[model samples]
Target chain A: MAVQTIGHAPASSSHKGMSPLRRREAINGYVAILPWFLGFLIFTAGPMVYSAWLTFNSWELITPPRWVGLANFRFLLEDQLFRTALWNTFIYTVVSVPLQLLIALGVALLLNLNIRGTNLYRSLIFLPSQTPVVASAMLWFFIFSPTQGLANAGIGLFGIPPQRWLWDVNLVKPALIAIAVWAFGGAMIIFLAGLQDIPQSLYEAADLDGATPFSKLLNITVPLLTPTIFFNLVIGLIGAFQVFTPVYLMTGGGPGTSSMMMGLLIYRHGFEEFNMGYASLLAWVLFLIVITLTIIQFSLARRWVYYEGDRD
Target chain B: MDTHVSPEVKNLQGQRPLMQDHAADDTTARSRSLVVPRKRRAVVVHLILFAVAAVSLLPLLYMVSTSLKARGREFAYPIEWIPNPAVWRNYLTAVETVEAMTFFANTMIVTTLTLVGGILTASLAAYGFARTRFPGRDFLFMLMLSSLMLPYMVTLIPQFVLFRELGWINTLYPLIVPAFFGGAPFYIFLLRQFFRGLPTDLEDAAKLDGAGFFRIWWTVAMPLAGPALATVAILSILHHWNDFIAPLVYLHTRDNWTLALGIRLFRDQYQVLFNLTMAYAVMMTVPVFTVFFAFQKYFVRGITISGMGGR
Candidate 1:
C-alpha cells in the first residue's frame, strides 16, 4: 500500500495514465494521512520499540539506559507492588467482564421485547453509558460517601449497614466494579444491535418445535449471539484492565494503592514520577498480558462463538 | 442547542417512511389471525418496559432532587426525595467555584480541535483503505485493528515520552496533535467501512468532472455521507470531552485543565458540599445530554447503520 501510494506519486504520475489533478489527489490524500502515519512511526511505533529496549534496562529518563539484560524483568519478578497490581488487574478483569456481559445481555434481551416506547427504555439505559466518567465518578463519590451517601441510605432499607466504599482497600475494587457495571450500556447497545440482527426464522423454527423460551435461548439465541458476546467480552476485559479514570477520580488510587490500576501506576511512574523507563517496563508487561489473553480468547472463540450465517 | 431536534437528524422524515411501511405490512399480513393475541402480549410487555424505564431514570431524578435541596436538607435523615426549600444557588455556587466558564471554554477548544483533527485523519486513512486498492492495504488495516487490542496502557508511557521530547508535555498538543494521525483506530475502521459502502459512481463522476481525489472526497463523498460524518463527529466530541487520563498526564498547569479534570477538583475540594457537587455533575451532563437528545434519531441511526456495515 505504501509502495503503491509512493509509486503513484512519481512512477504512475509520469505514465500519462492520469492527469495532474489525479496526481494532486493522490498526493493530497497521502498528505492528509501523513500526520497519523508520522505519528504512528514517531509516537506509537517508536515508543513500542523504546519500551522493549527499556524493558531490559534500569535507566531513568535523565540518564542513558544501562543495559542490564534481564535485570528489570528479574526485578519485576520480585516486585511486590507489580505482583499486587497484576493480581488486582486479573481479579478486576475476571470479575467485571463476565458480569458486565451478563447484565448487558439481560438488558438487551429485555429491551428486545416488542413493547411501547422501547426507545425510551433504550435511551434511559444508555444514559449512564454516555455520561462522562469524570462526572459519574463525582456523582458516585457523593453517592458512596461513607457517612451520608445515598447508596448506604438505600442499602439501609435492605438492612445492610454503611460500608466504606473507596476507603477500605478490600471493598475498593468491588466498589469500582459496581460503578463499572453502571456503564454496561456500551455492551448492551452492541448486544441490542446483535439481537436485532438475529433472523426471526430461527425463532419461528424453534417455536414450531415447541421449544420453550429457556430452551430456545439455550439452543439458538445464546449460540448465535456468541460472536457479539465474545466481542463485547474481549473489549470489556481490555477496557476493565486499563480502567484508570474512575479509580483516579473516586479514590486517587488510594486509601493506599487499593485502586492503583495498572494504568494509574504507569501514569504515576511516567508522568508523575518522571520515571519513563520503569513505566515503559510496566507498560510492556501490560501489553503482553492483553495480547496473550486476547489470543486465548480468539482461540477459544472458535469453539463457542458461532456465526449462524456462515453455514459451512 | 435545541433539545427536541436530534443533532444529526433534522427530520424523522428519513426513518418514518420505513417504519410506517413495516407497520402496515405487519398489520395486513397478520390480520387474518393471531394479531389480537400478539398485540395483547405486546401491550403487557410494554408496561413491563415502562417500569424498567422508570427504574433507569431514578438516579437522574435523585440527582435533580439533591441539586435542589438546601445544603443541610441534602443529607437530611429519612432522606428527602424532594427539596424542602429549593436552593437555586446550588447551580450558581457550583458554576462559580470551579471557574466553570473557563473549564467550558477549555473543553470546547479541546473538543473542537480534536474533532477536526480526528475527522481529517480518520477519513484520510479510511479513504486510502477504501479506494486505493494498494498492496498490503488489508494487511495494514489488520495491523491497525490489532493495535486496538493493545490497551492504551501500553503506548501511554511512550507517548508521554515522545510528547515530552517535542515540548508538548504540558500543552494541549499531545492530546490534539496525535488525533490528526489516526489516533483511534476504531473510528478509522468505522469511516473505512462507511466509505467502502458508498457507491463509486459519485467519485468517478467527480473524476470525470476534472476533480481530484481530495475534491471528490470533500465535494462528492462527504455530501453524501452526512449521517456517517455526523456519527464520527459526535463520537469524537464525546471522547475528547470526556477524556481524563491524557489531559491529566499531559497538562500540568491548573488553567489548562479540561472539564473532566475540573469536575474531579470540585469533588475533592468540596467534599462536604454534596448539593453543589451534584449541581456540578448535572451541569457537566446537561450539555452532552442536550446534544444527545437533539441528535438522538441520527445518533441511533448512525449507530445501527455503522454497526451493520463495520462488523
Candidate 2:
C-alpha cells in the first residue's frame, strides 16, 4: 500500500504499465508458496537425489558408501525376497484395484438410487475406512484367524473348512484385497459424486432405446464413469504398492516371509538391516515402478478415459 | 494443463455407446429404473443394500462386541455377535495398564499442531496461487502437484537420515513440523481450487481500500472460504488421526507413541487375548467415530473434492 506508484493502476493494463505491481505480486506468490518449496527442498528433493545416489552405492548405516553400480538392481532381479515382494505387490494390486473399483461403483450405484437413508448407509459403509490401519488389521487379524475367527465361522456354516488366511502364502494377498474391498467407501463416495454428474437424461435415452439394466450399466454408466475409475485406479495402485501398516501389524511379512510386500522389504533392509544404500536402491526401484505405472496409466487413458469435450 | 482425454471416447459418447460397439449385450435383463420398482422390488433392493451395508459394518461391530467380552468369551466356539454381559472393565483395563490415555493425548497434540500448520500454510499458499499475479505460477503449481506422485519410499531412508541429523527422529517434530511447510500437496491443491471458486469482488474492494495482499486474503478470502477450510480440516483429521506409517517410523519410545502406534504395540503386547487387542482398537476408534458423526457433511464433500481434482 505504501508503494503508491503501482497502486490502483487501470484494469487489464499492458505488462509494461504494471511491472512493479506485477513484480510485487510475483514475489508474494513465491513467498506464499515458499514454505512448500522449502519443504520440497528438504524432505522431498534432497532425499530423492540422495536416494538416487545411494542406488549406485552400498552403505550400511555406519560405513561410508561404496560404489556398487547396478549391483543392487541386479541383485533385486535374482534376489528371492525382492522377487517375492515385487510379485506380492503386483498380485495384490492387480487383484485388489479392480475389486475395490467394482465394489465401490456397485455401492455408489446403490446409494445413488433415490433411496431413503442414503446418508446412513454411506456412513456405515465408510466407518471402516475411518478406523486406523493398525486397528483394522488388529481386528481383522483375529477375524481371519484360522480356528476361532468369525470369517472362518461364517464360512464353516457352508462346510468349507477354516483356512489359514494371512498366514497362508497364497491366500494372504486375497485376504488383503478383501480388506481393501471392505473399506471401499472412500472411492464409493467419489463414485457417487461422479454418478451425480452423469446426466439422468442419459438413462432416459437408454430407456427409449429399450436397453436392458445390465446393458444400460455396461454401456452408459460404465463408460461415463471411466474417468473416476481411472482416478481411483492410479491412486489405489500407488497406495497398494506402499502397503505396509497392515502387513507390519498383522503378518510381520508372514509365517515364512510369504506376505513380504515391497514396503516391508524396504523397511527391513533400510531400518532393520541398517543397509541404507540397498534400501535406497530398492526404494528407487519402487519409485520407478510407481512412476512408470502412472505414466503408463496416463498414456493408456488416451484409449479409454473419456473427457466430455476433448475431441477436435 | 496436464489434462488427458481419449479422442475416440469424446466422439463415441456423443452419439451412442450402444449397438455397433457390441453384440454381446445381455438383452434378457430388464432396465428397472425405466419404471418405478414395485413394492416387492423395493423390498428386495432395501434388503440387498442392507445386507451389503451390514457386511461393510460387520468387522466394526465385531470389534466393539469383542472389546466388551469377558474372559474365555473371545474366540469362543460360536462367534458371538454380542457380549453376554458386556464388560466395561476392558475399557478401564486398557486405560489403566497401557496408559492408552497417554497415546490419545499424544495423538491430540500431533493432530492439533499438524492441522493448524497444514491449514495455515496451505491456505496462504493457496491464496497466492489462486489470486496473486504470479509469474511461473502454473509451472510451480505443477511442480507441487507432481510431488503427489513421488513415492515416499524414495524419501524414507534419506528423510529418516535427515530427521536424525536434525535430532527429530524419536519425537513428533518429524511428523508435525513438515506440515508447517505446506506438506500436504493435495490440500494445497484443494484449497487453491476452493479459493479460486470464491467471488473476487471482496479482494478487489479490499485492494482499492489500500489493503495489501495479506489483508485482502485474510480479511476477504479467508472469511469466504469457511466451507472449504472446514473441508480441509475435516480431511486432515481423517488423515492425521489415522496416520500409521509416520508414527511407526518417527516415534520409537512407547510413551511418545500416537494412538496408531500405541495400539499396534498394545496389540502385540496382548497378542494372546484377542478381546484385549480389540479393546485397544475400540478405544482408538471412538474419537474418530465421534468426529465423523460430528462432521459427516464435510467428510463426504472433502473426499469428493479430492477425487474431483483430477478432472
Candidate 3:
C-alpha cells in the first residue's frame, strides 16, 4: 500500500504543471528503484508485518494458525531460557564490543605509523577476519581444546594449569568473547582508514606546539577519530548482539545453557522445535532491545562524537 | 606559461624536485644524530608490528599446521608447529566424508549467481538514487537505510514460511532470488556514494549525442566505476562464499548444501578428528583468502569509502 501510494503520488504530482523532462526523470527514477522497492516490500516489510502477526498466534507449520492474543509475549516474559539468552547476549555485547574496538584501535595506530612492511602486517592481521565463521570457530575450538589444545600448551609454558574452555560453563562465554575479539581485523581495517583520513597538518601543528606523542594522541587523534569510533561502535554493537555462528557451532549454548545467545535461541525455537510463534516473539524482544540501545547510543553520541565541519 | 618554456627549461623543471630531494638527503645525513633515534623508533615499531601480526596469524597458522598433521597426533601435547609426515590424506578424507565436491559445486553456483544478480541490481538501484530525482526520493532512501537496523532474525521465520509455501525450500532459490531484486542495502549505499562522486560532464555530452538515460548509465557511468564495481564484486564473493545461516535455513537436504554447510557437517561428523576438521576448514577458507589478496586494494578502498559515508 505504501509502495503504491509513493509510486502514484510521483506520477500524479507530475501533472501539476511539471515539465516534460522532469516528469520523465521522475518516472525513470521510480523504474530504476523498482527492484529494490519490490524487495523491500516482499523480503523486509512484508515479513516484518507477518512476523508481528505470527507472534500473536500459534502455528506449527502443519495446522491452521490459531489466534492466541498476547500469549506468546506473556510466555516470553517468564521463559528462563529466553532470559538466559538475553543476559548472555547482553554480557557478550557489553564486554566484547568495547574490547574489540579498543584492540582494533590499538592495532590501527601501530599500522598507521607507516613502518616498513605495513602492507604485509595489515594483510596478515586482516586475513583471520576473512576466515569463514564456521572455520574460525573450528580453529578456535582446536586452539581452546583442553587436552591437546594449543591454549593449554601455551599456558603450560607459563606454568598455568589447564582449563576447559568451551566445555566449562563459567569459561564458555569468555572463550566465545576471545574468539569474537580475534576477528577484530575488520574493525581494525576501518579504523586504519579513519586514521589515514586525519590531515597530516594537524599532527604537524601539534609537532610545532612541542606536543608529546601521548598528548597529541589525546587532543588531535582521538577527537578527530571520534566519528569513526562511533561508526565502529554502532556496527560492533549490532553485530555483537546477534552473534550466533560461533556459539552455535562451538558450544550450542551448552554446559547448562551458559552460552545461549538470542540468535541461537530464535533458531532453536523456529527451526528446531517448529515453534514459529514463540520464536517470532523472542525475535521481536531482541529487536526492541537493539533498537532501544541504538537510540540510547545516538542520544549519548551528541555529547561526545565530534564531527569536523559541524557548526552546532 | 608552458608555451614560453623551452625544452631545456622544461627538463630542468622536471628535475627540480629530484635536486631538492638530494639537498634534503645531504642535510639529513649531516643530522645523522637526529635520524638515529628516529631510526631506532622505527625498529621498535617494526618489532611491535611483527609481533602483533604473528599473533594475529597464529590461529590460522595453527590451523594449517593441524590440518597437515597425522590424525591422532593433532592434539599431541608438545604441539607440532610443523608436521614431519604431512597427512595429505586428511584433505581427501575430509572431502570424501562430506561429499564436499558436490557442496563445492553448489557453493560455486550460488556464489556466482548471487554475485551477478547482486552487482547488477544493487548498481542499478544505486544509479537511480544517486543520479535521478523524484518525489520522496530522500524519504525512500532513508527508509531503505533504516531497514538495515532491523535484525535478520525478525524476518527469518516469516521468510522461511513464505519460501516453504512457494516450495523454494531445500532449493537455492531462496538464497539467490532476493539477490536479484536488490542484493544487500549496504552494497547499494556503497555504490550510490561511488556513483555520486563520478562526474556528470560525460553524461551531459552523451545526452547531447541523443543518448538516453539508460545508455548514458551503461556506457558512461558503469565504465567509469571500475574500482567500485571491483569492490562490490569482491565483497559479494566473500559474503556468499562465507554465508552460513541463509543456506542452513533454506537448504535442508545434503544434495543442496553449500560448502559452508558441508564444512559444518564435516565438523559435526568428525568432531574428534581435529585433523580432518582442520583440513575441511582450510579447504573452505582458501578461496576467500585468494580473493582478498588479489583484490586487496579494492577491498581496502571499499571499506574506506564506507567509513567516509559516516562523515
Candidate 4:
C-alpha cells in the first residue's frame, strides 16, 4: 500500500500495470549495468566457452579446427619440456611465496612502529614494486650477467667471488626468486594495514600485565593477523603460478628450459609454435591446478582465519 | 573511500596518541633517570631502515647509472657504480633507433582511453549493483565476481580470435575496446565496494527533490566519488601502461607497439648492448615512480578499503 501510494502513475497505464516506482528502478538498473553485462558476455564468458572447445580441436590460425579429442591432453603428459616447465614453476612458487610473505610482514611490523618517518620508509620500500614488470625483467638481465652484472659487483664489495646467475641452470630459478622477493612492497602494505586493524587496547592490556613484546606478538598479533596472511598467501600463489614476462624476456626459457614456467610454455605452444590446441590444453591444466590449490587453501583457512565478530 | 573506520584503523588512531604519550613519558622519565636504551633502539631501527632502502633502490640506481655511463663503460669490470662521464645520449639514441616516440604515443592513447572508459563503465555497473534495487541483483553480482576467479589464460585464446575476427589485430583497438565495454572485473568490484560505502542520505535527498536515477547518480554519487575514481584511474593507467602479453599477442607492427612491447623489441634488437637496453628500462620505469609518489596516499587508502581479497 505504501509503495502504491508513493507513485503518481501506473508504469503502463493499466490497472494490472506494474508500479511506476518498481518499473522505473528495474529499467534504471538494466540501463546502468548493461555495458558490463554485454562485455561480460562477449569478452569474458563467450571466450571462456570458446577456449574450452579450442582445447579439444587442433587449430593453427590459418587452418580449420580439426577435432582431436584427448590427444592434446595426452601430448602434455608425455612432453618432457612440459614436465620441466611444471617442475621449475613449482620450485619458484614454493620457494618464493613464503619468503616474500615473511619479509613483507617483517617490514610491515617495522613500519607499524609508532615512530617518525614511517611513511617515507613505506614509500621507499614500495617503490620497486611499482616498476613495470617488463622493465624490471630487463633490469634483472643486467644484474644476472656473470662477468658484468651488479650481482657480481655488489658481492665484489664484500670480497666474494663473482657468480653466474640466471645463466647458470642451477641458479636461474633461485635468482628469479631473489628478484621476486625484492618486490614484496605490495604485500607489505597490506600487512601494515592489517597491523593497524589489530586493536591497540589488546596491546595496552597486555602491557599493563607486563607481557614481553615477543610474547604479545606471538599470542595476540599473530592470531589476529591470520586473515591478512591468508590473503597474501592466496594472492602470491596465483601471481607466482603465472610467472611469464621475466622468463620470456630475460632467458627465453633458456640454458635448456631451466627457467620455463607453465605460462611461458603455454605462450610458446599457442603463439610461437602455432599449436593452439596444445596451448589451450596446457592453459586449462594450469587453471585446474590453481583452482585446486585455491580450494585447498580455503578449506584450510576455516581452521585459522578469524573474523572480529566471529566469536561474538 | 575509507568510509568505514574498521576496528583496525580505529585501533591505529587510538595507538598514535598512546605512542605520543609514551614519548612524553620517556622525556619525563629521562629527567628522572635513564632514557639511553630507548634512544639507542630508535637509532638502531633507523639504521636498519636505511640499509633496506639502499638495497631496495639499488637496482633502480643501477639502471639509471648504466643508462648514463659512457657507451662502452656500461659493462666495465669493477663496474662504474657512478658513471664517470654520465652520457645522456643513450636516451636520445634508444628513442631514435627504436621509434620509441611512436610507442609512447600509442601507449598514451590506449592507457588514457582505458582509464576514462574503464572508470565510466565500471562506475555505472557498480552503481547498478550497489545503489539500485532490482530483481536478481545479488545473483548477477555473484556472477560478475565469479569472473575474477576465472584465469585470464582460460579466456586468452578465444579473445585473440575475437579480435582477429573483428580485424582489430596489429592495432591499438584490441587493447582499447574491451575497456570501453567493462574494463576488468577487479576494477568493477572495487568501484562497487566504493559505491556501497556511500551514505543512503544523499540519494534519499535526491529522490525527495524528484531527481531521476541518472541525475542522482551524476549529481549525488559522482560528486562524492572523486577519490575512488582517481584510484581506479591510476590503477588502470598502471595496468595498461605496463601490459606486456596483450600487446605482445596483438601488436606485430613496431609502429603499433606500446612502451612495454617497445622495450622487448629493443632488447631483442640490441641483446648484448647493456647500456641501450638499460636506457630503455629507465624510460619505462620512471613514470611508474612518478605516479606512485604523487598518489601514494590515495593508493594506500584504496587498498585498505578493498584489500580483503577484493571479495
Candidate 5:
C-alpha cells in the first residue's frame, strides 16, 4: 500500500525536471538492498538453480561433474534408503501436523480464559519455543535416556513400564513429535489472537441459545478459526518437512536409519558423503513435496476455512 | 484485509438490548452468588494454569538442577531434586573448561555482524518493495516472496560448495555475508509491512523539500520505525545466537566455534558427562533467557502487532 505513495508521483514533466534525484533515489534503494541481492545471487537462488542442474549429473566434489542426465533421479527410483526416508517423512508429517495443531488450539483456548497471571503462563509456555533447539534436543535426549530418564520416572508412578523413546525404532518419530508439540506454545499464542478476533456476540448468542461450551467450540470456534489453522498448517507443513536440528542432535537418524529424515539424508549425502548431485535431487524431491502439499492444503482450505464478513 | 465493521451493525448494536436486561435481572437475583462463582472460576483457571506452567518449566528446571548437581549425580535416582552440596564449580569449570570465553567472543562477533547486516539489508529491501515503482519491481518482490517459501535446506549443499570454492569454509564469512544480503525473506516482509503502515505525508514533504529517499528514510522513517527495528534486531540476535548448523557446517577449527557449536563440542567429546553438559547448557541458556526477559514486553508486542499488521 505504501507503493501507492510512489504511484502518486507527479506527472512526466515534473518527473523529468527531478530525474537525477529520482534516479539517485532508485540507485540508493538498489545499493541499500544490494547485500541481499548479492546473497540471493551467490547463495540462495544461485545454489537453488545450481542444485537443479546438479540433479542431472553424477558429481562428487573430488572429480568433474560427469554428464549423466537424470542419473540421480533414476537412482532415486530404486534407492532403498530414499524410500525409507520418504516413508519416515510421510509418517512424521501425517501424524504430527494435525496433532500439533489440535494441541496448540487446546492450549490457546485454555490460555484465552482471562485467567490470573496470563503473562506468566504465556512466558512459561513460550519458554520452550525460545530454547535453543540443540539444547532442547539434548535435554530430550537425556529425558529419553532409556533407563534413568525423567519421562519414565514420572510416568512410572502410574505403574507403566519404561519404554524406549528416542532409542526404539518405532518410538523415534513419536519422540520427535513430542518435541514438536512442546514448541506448540508459539502457535498457540497465534491461534489465541485469532480467537480474540472472533466477534464476542457470536459466543454470547450461542450461550443465550443454551449452547454448551463444547457445542459452541465445535460450532462457532473451530469453523471461524479455520483461516488461522490454515495459515499454521501451511507453515507447520513446511517446517515439519525441513526438520533437521532435532533429528541431528537427538538420534542422528539412528536405529539403523529408521528415523533418518529426508533433510538429514540430504545433509549426510551433501556434506558427509560429498555426493552433491544426489543430495540436490533429494532436496528437489523434498521441495516438490512441500510445494505440492502446500498447494493441496490451500486448495482444500476453500471448502473448510470460513472468513466471517469476508465478501470475497 | 481489515474490512470495515459496518456502521449498520454499530447502530443495530446500539438499538438492541443485548444481555443488558437479562444481566440486570440476574444480578438482582444473584449478585452476591456471582462473586463466589467468579472467584471459584478464577481459582480453577489459576490452578490449571499454574499446573501447566509447572509442567512447561520442568525441562528448564531440570537443566538448571543438573547444572548444579555434583558430578556423577545426573543419573542418580530416587531423583535428587536438590543437590546436597551444590557443585558451584560447575559454572566456573564449564566456562573455563571449553574455551567458553573465545566461543562467546566468536558468537558475539558473528551474531552482531549478522544482526547489523540483517537489519540494514532487510530494511532497505523492505523500503524498496514498500515505496518504489521501478520496472519489474513487483515481479522482483514476488520473486522474493516466492523465495520465502523455498525450502532453505535445498540451498545448503550448493551454498556450502560455493563457499568452499570461495575459500569461505572454516570462516564466519559464509555465515555472516549472506545475512547482510537479505538472506531471510520473512524479516524483510515483516519490516515492509511496518513501513507500508506508516503515513506517506513525511516522504511526500521530503520530496517537496528536494530531499532524496535515503535522506527522508534516515531523517523521518527510521525514527518512526523504532519499535519495528527493535523487533527485527532482537529476533535477529536471538536467531544467530541459537544457530548451530551453520557454524557446524562452516567452522572446522574448535577455536573458531560459536557458543552453540561449542556447547555441542561437550556432547561430542563427553557424551556420558551429563553433569558438565547440563552445566554448560545452563550457562548457554541463562543469558538468552535474560535477554528474553529484558525485551519481553517489546517482543510480545511486536509479535501481536505483526500478526495484526499481516491482516
Candidate 6:
C-alpha cells in the first residue's frame, strides 16, 4: 500500500510541480495570513530596521534625522543614567523573577492538595493579577506612603518603625519587588496546571515506597514540573527586565534613579526628552540583553528541563 | 474510592492498569493508617492557603477601605479597616472630578474595537498557520514566533515615528489600527494551538462538499473555536482596558483620555486626595474583575495552554 501511494504521487504530478489542489491551498494560505504578514512588515520588521538605523543618528524628532555613526553608542557607554538604569533593571530581574517563581510554585503545590474550596482559593490568589497594573501601582503608592501608608502601619504592629518606602533608595527596589510578588498568581495558576499534568500514579508509587512528602516533591514532582518552571522563568525574566508601569507611575525612576528601569528610561528619552535616537539605541540594547538571556536559558534548559515524551 | 483523584487522573488510570492497581492499594492502605495525620495536614494546608489568600486580597481591601473613608481619615493611624460611614459619594466625586464618564466612553470604544479586531485578524492568521499546508509556512510561523522575544520597546520609537508620519498621533487610530493587523503575536500563536487541536474530519467533509477554505474556517472551524475566541476576547479586553503607555503617548488632550490615563491624571492633580484616587482606581478595576469572574475557566485554560508551549 505504501509503495502504491508513493508511485501514485509522481504519476499524478510532474517532478518539481505542485498539483492544482496544492497550488490552490497555498494561495488560500497566503491570503489567510496576509494581514499578519503585512502587520509583520509594517509594524514589527520595518520598525525594527528603522530603530536600528535610528541608533546611529541623533535626531530630536523635529529635525530630519542626520546620521552620526556610533555616536549614540559611544555616549551610551559613558552615560551614567544609562548604566544606572541597566544595573537597576538587571538587579530587579535577577532578584524578583526567581522569588516570584518559588512563591508561585509553593502556592500551587499547596492548592494541589485536592482540598475543598480549591476553586475559591485559586480565585482569591489570582485576583490581584487581574487588577490593572496602573490601578495596582496607585494602590501600592498609597500603601507605601511614608506616614499614613499601610506598609508602615502593618510593620508598626510588628514593632519595626516605619521607614521611607519608595522614597528611601535602599527600600525602593524591595518595595517594587514586593508589588511584583503580589501578582505571582498568573504563574501560580500555570504551576497548578503543571502540577495537575503530573500523573498521580507516580505520587502513589512514591507513597507506596514510604517516601516522605519532601522526598516525593524532590524526586517526582520537581522533575515532572521542570518544563513548567522553565516556562515561567523565561517569561518572568523577560517581564521583570521590562518593568515600567510601576516605576513610571509610582517613583518615576527616582528617589535618585534607585528604581530606574530600562522601559521607563526608553520612554523618558523618546517621549519626554524627545531624543528619539538615543531612545532607539537604548531600546536596541534592551532587546539584545533580553535575546541573549533567552538564548542562554534555552541552551541551559537541555540539562535540566524534562519533557515527558522525550525518546532519550 | 479516593475522592482526591480528579477525573483526569481517573482517565490516566484507565489507560494503565498496573498503576491503577498500585493507586488502589496505596489509597486503601494510606486511608486506613493515616486518617489522623491527613486531617491535620488538611488543617495546616487550609491555614496556609487562607493566609496567602489574605495577603493577596489585603491591598485591594485596603483600596476599598480608603476609597470610602471620610476625606481626612485616610491617614488615620491604626488603619481603619472600614469607614465609619461609607463615603459612597466619593464615587460621584471621582467621576465629577476628572471627566470620568468621558474616559469611560473612550476606554469602551478603544477596548471594544481592539477586542473585536484582534480576535478577527488573529484567528484568521492562526487558521492559516494551523490548518493549511503551504511552502515556507513553518518558516514564516517560526519567524513570527521569534518576534515575541523582540521587546515592544525596540519598536516603540519607530512605531511612534511611523504613526506621527501618518498624522495619527493624538488620535485613537494608533491604538486601534494595530489590532486589525495582528499586532499581538501571542494571541495568534494561542489561537493557532487551539485550531490545531480541533478535529479535522469536519473540515475534510466540508472540503468534499465543495466548500472553500474560508467557508470551512468560518462555518466549521470557527464555530468550534468558541472557547479560544472567548479567551482571546477576554485577554484583549483586559489589555486594551488597562493599556497606559499607548494612551499616555498618543492622547494628549483630556477630552480623549482613556480610563488609565484619566486615573493617572487624577492621581497627579489630586496628589493629596488618596480617597478620590482610590475611588477612581476601584471604578477602573470593577469591569476587569467582572469579566474575569464570568470567564474564569477560559483564563485558566489559556494560561495552561501557554505554559504547555501550546501543545
Q: CA lDDT of each candidate? A: 0.73, 0.80, 0.83, 0.80, 0.77, 0.85
- Cα lDDT of model 5 by residue, A1-312, tens digit: 323444444434343455775666556757666666777787777888888999988878888888789778888999999999888888887888788788778777878877777877878877776777767877888888888878888888899999888889988888888777777666776787798887897766554443446777777778779989888788788878887888888789988888999989998998888888999999999999999999999899889898775643
DockQ of each: 0.26, 0.40, 0.34, 0.38, 0.37, 0.44
| Most DockQ-accurate candidate | 6
Tens digit per residue, CA lDDT, model 3, A120-192: 9998988877788889988898899877698888789999899998899999999998888888888889998
User: What is the C-alpha lDDT profile of model 6 across A1-312, one tens digit per residue?
Assistant: 112223222343332488788788878988989998999999999999999999999999779999999899899989999999999999888988898889999999999997999889998898897788888999999999988699999898889998899999999999999999898888898999889889888776555445568867876788889999999998888878888889998999989999899999999999999999999999999999999999999999999998876733
lDDT of 1 by residue, A153-228 (tens): 8889999998888898888889888777767777787888888888786675444333446766776678778988
Better of 1 and 3 by TM-score: 3
Question: What does candidate 1's lDDT look like per residue over B185-253, in tens digits?
Answer: 777877787888898987998889888777777888778877777888887787787888888888888
Candidate 2 residue spans exceeding 4 A from truth:
A1-18, A205-215, B1-37, B267-270, B307-311
Candidate with better TM-score, 3 vs 4? 3
Best by lDDT: 6
How well does candidate 6 score on lDDT at residue A33? 90
Candidate 3, residue A192: lDDT: 89
Better of 4 and 5 by lDDT: 4
Better-scoring candidate (TM-score), 1 or 4: 4
| Interface RMSD (one decimal) of model 2 | 7.5
Cα lDDT tens digits for candidate 4, B1-311: 11223354335233432343454445555444535766777788888887888899999889898988876687898777788788889899898888899999999999999888898888888888777666656667778876776766677778888898999999898889899887787788888878888988989998999999888888899889999888888778878888899899999988888989877554444356778878998888878778777888777665554442111
Question: Number of backbone collisions per candidate, in order?
Answer: 7, 0, 0, 1, 3, 0
Report iRMS (Å) of candidate 6.
Answer: 6.4
Q: Over the stretch B28-63, how does candidate 5's per-residue lDDT look in tens digits?
A: 456575668878878887877778778778988888
Local lDDT at B122 for model 3: 90
Better of 2 and 5 by DockQ: 2
Q: Chain B TM-score per candidate, please.
A: 0.82, 0.85, 0.85, 0.84, 0.86, 0.87
Q: What is the lDDT of residue B94 in candidate 2?
A: 76
